[model samples]
Target chain A: MTPTDLRAAFIADLTAVAPDLDPAAIGDNDHMQDDLGLDSMDFLNLVSALHKRFGLPIPEADYPRLATAALAVAYLDQALAE
Target chain B: MSIFTMPSLGADMEEGKLVEWLVKPGDDVKKGDIVAVVETQKGAIEIEIFEAGQIGALLAEPGQTLPVGAPLARLGVADEAEVTDPVAAPEPAIQASRAAALPAPAPAPAAKPVAAAAPGDAVLASPAARARAAELGIALEAVTGSGPGGAVLLSDIENHVSAGPQPAAQPVAEDRPKGKPGLDMTEMRRAIAAAMSRSKREIPHYYLMHEIDLQSAHDRLTALNADRTPDRRLLMGAFLLHATVKSLAKVPELNGRYDVEPYAPSGQVHCGMAVAMRGGGLIAPAILEAQSKDPDEIMAAMRDLVARTRSGRLRNSEITRGTITISALGENGVDALIGVIYPPQVALVGFGAPRVRPMVHDGTIQPRLAVTVSLAADHRVSDGRRGALFLTEIDRLLQEPAIP
Candidate 1:
């Protein structure tokens, strides 16, 4: 998938975890947990959603790479490329 | 025949407004079936019936607020023929007939007074709608009503908020209000205040804290989840809950209710898990018969409970049947939290975030993932020694964490 598609997919999963979140309000560099207020369960759910969407095995060690929206899209894009 | 009353969802809940009836009269419903939805301070909880029967009559009308123990509906035996004559049944049956007959003519006139009342005097809105509006900081008068008799509903409030124009400027974190989105903070605060106040006033609580090394438990969980998917993976909180349940076996004194003068011990452990809602506040619902459940089962139950609690779909029994409560602050929480015992329940177990701290292991200092476990027990039921033993048992159980 293209970078734009990957970004959209990540945002869709993020919104699914936190329905009240507005896509426009989230900045690229904002931390998902610290800024967006996604708790541990919510973060797990977001990872689960991304895994389901991208069909990738995201190890727990790599959770830190997906801390921000831009970081998540970039990580997923690189993983997809691999 | 039986009457399903408006259940007290929590100790603080005295009354709940009938939101909607999921089952109509003549609908067959068995035990544990969600028959209706009631709007309480917590949120709109889907109320379930414990008896198997056919719905005979819906005694309470939608949007009507009724006190705890007030009859919401009548149920007749599933095999028995529907009784057409209202006089043949009990007193509530007659009242049910009047309720059924009055809906067509009564609502129009009855609703007028509530709608016509001075602004904010009595806004004709469901409890859920009022809560949503309050959370959004939207005045009820500004939002157009779309419900029955032009009543403002939750959907209308959501639509109003979303369709309206954005604010001229985004409020910074410091300027933003205290509450999180999607929860009725004021109502929840009031409910929490009442319950905590009552707990402090009535229950003589004794607090105890213990630090448990979670290196073994953490390693076991890691091994368990190494090949598993996110959906099936176990959380550390599940281990804490399982250990708490098992430890209750050793200290049975802490696993019951203190409702009456004489403390009664529960034969089974219905573990109450304190799940924090998305916005703010928390609810402690039980995983019934938790003694039979393993760590994986506890994890699954906790996930389901968290989802249901967030969505406000909790059952009456889940809300009321907890014998002991456990509150675990997840990885993001502080070092430890000393909790207040939920009334009637004798003990509450609290698990703070597990952090890697230096501890003496094998006669040498080593970094281990250790957690602070705190217990608040009713002094009337159990003393500090029993409470300490209970904590020690939990520490012992976690030392060699159960894999299955």
Candidate 2:
């Protein structure tokens, strides 16, 4: 899948995890916590969602790389390529 | 036959709207089975049946809002003997069916509320009243009786909990963060206001705080998570829950509710963790029997509870029967919290954000990861010394990270 498709999928997963967030308003560079207002608990859930959708375990160390939509797409691309 | 009434979800819930019934007539249900889902101010909660029986008929229709204790269904005995004579059995069955077909009637009006009696040594009190008084650290001599025959009621004990904290409600309201628009938070706020104000006005609370060094636990958690994936990784909350339950075993008074009568120490620990909802408001549901689970199991339960609660689905037992409660502010928020004791409960434990701070051990100062732990306990049931011991036990238990 293209990077754009991956980003859309990631945002879809995020929206599923946090129903309060508006999908249209979410920007590519928006941080999940600061901008979208996901609490630590919600943030953990987002991570869990990503793990489930990709069928791969996400390392805790890689959490920082997936902070924003753009960054999450980039991280997913690299992880998927490897 | 037994009438299944709506169960009380919490102290704040007045009534619930029956959205759907998971069972129908002639369905046999065991105790603890979710029979229906009711939507309340909190959210959709799956109502469970406490008796094993076959549902004879549903009295309440879907989408109907019913008050607490209003009968929703009629249940027939599960193990009733089958009639052998076909002719005789059909007659009895027809009669029984007629009886069950009748609509449920409105509950009888409650007895008139008696006015509080005058205060004196002659004041009569319920066993629960005396127990609540002992739990709140209040002397019953000053409280006026409100029950029949000039007996003191449990409400009286709560009403006499503290002398002056009652005045802080106004200022606290002024300082509360305003709710975002479009999300109906008024009812939620009012429920919170009533419960917290009642807690402050009635429970004689004594506060105790201790700083715990979490460096060892932190390192151990990191080591445990190093090779694990995000889905399998355990959150710090699981450790806190495990430690809290273990400590309650040592300090039995910290567990159990105080109302009507002082119950013996709970046989199992139902540790309630406060979960903040997305729109507004909070609910503390338990991870039942936390003492029996390891950290990993606790984490799984915690995740499931939060997810289900946020998704507007919870079980009946989750909202009630909490022996103790824990409120953790995670890693970003406040330094410490002196939470109000949720009523009927004897104690509440709080955990502030875990941060790195300078520490002195063996005469050398070094930066260490630490968190502030605070306990707001009913002064009537346990003293500050016992509360301190409870916190100390948590600190000691966390260091070893052993779950047997």
Number of the predicted model whose lDDT against the real structure is largest? 1
Tens-place lDDT per residue, model 1, B1-404, is 55577788887887787877777666779889998888777767878888797776566676667777666766666655443323222335434545564442111111111111122224579888887765664546556689997799999888987887422122222343333332456777788899899999999999999899999989988888889877777788888899899999998999988877688889999899887765667878899999999888888888788767765477778778899999988887799999999988989999898899999999999999999999999999899999999999988988873455
lDDT tens per residue, model 2, B115-194: 22211223468878877765554435446567896687898877766453222111112243433322236656777787
What DockQ does each prediction reach against the true complex?
A: 0.24, 0.51
lDDT of 1 at B208: 96
Q: For model 1, how does the per-residue alpha-carbon lDDT over A20-78 read when each residue is reduced to its tens digit?
A: 57888989999987788777777888888888887888888889999998898889989
Model 2, residue A22: C-alpha shift (Å): 2.0
Q: Give candidate 2 misplaced runs (Cα > 4 Å).
A: B81-184, B401-404
Worst 10 residues of 2 chain B by lDDT: B81-90
True contacts kept of each: 0.17, 0.43
lDDT of 1 at B218: 91
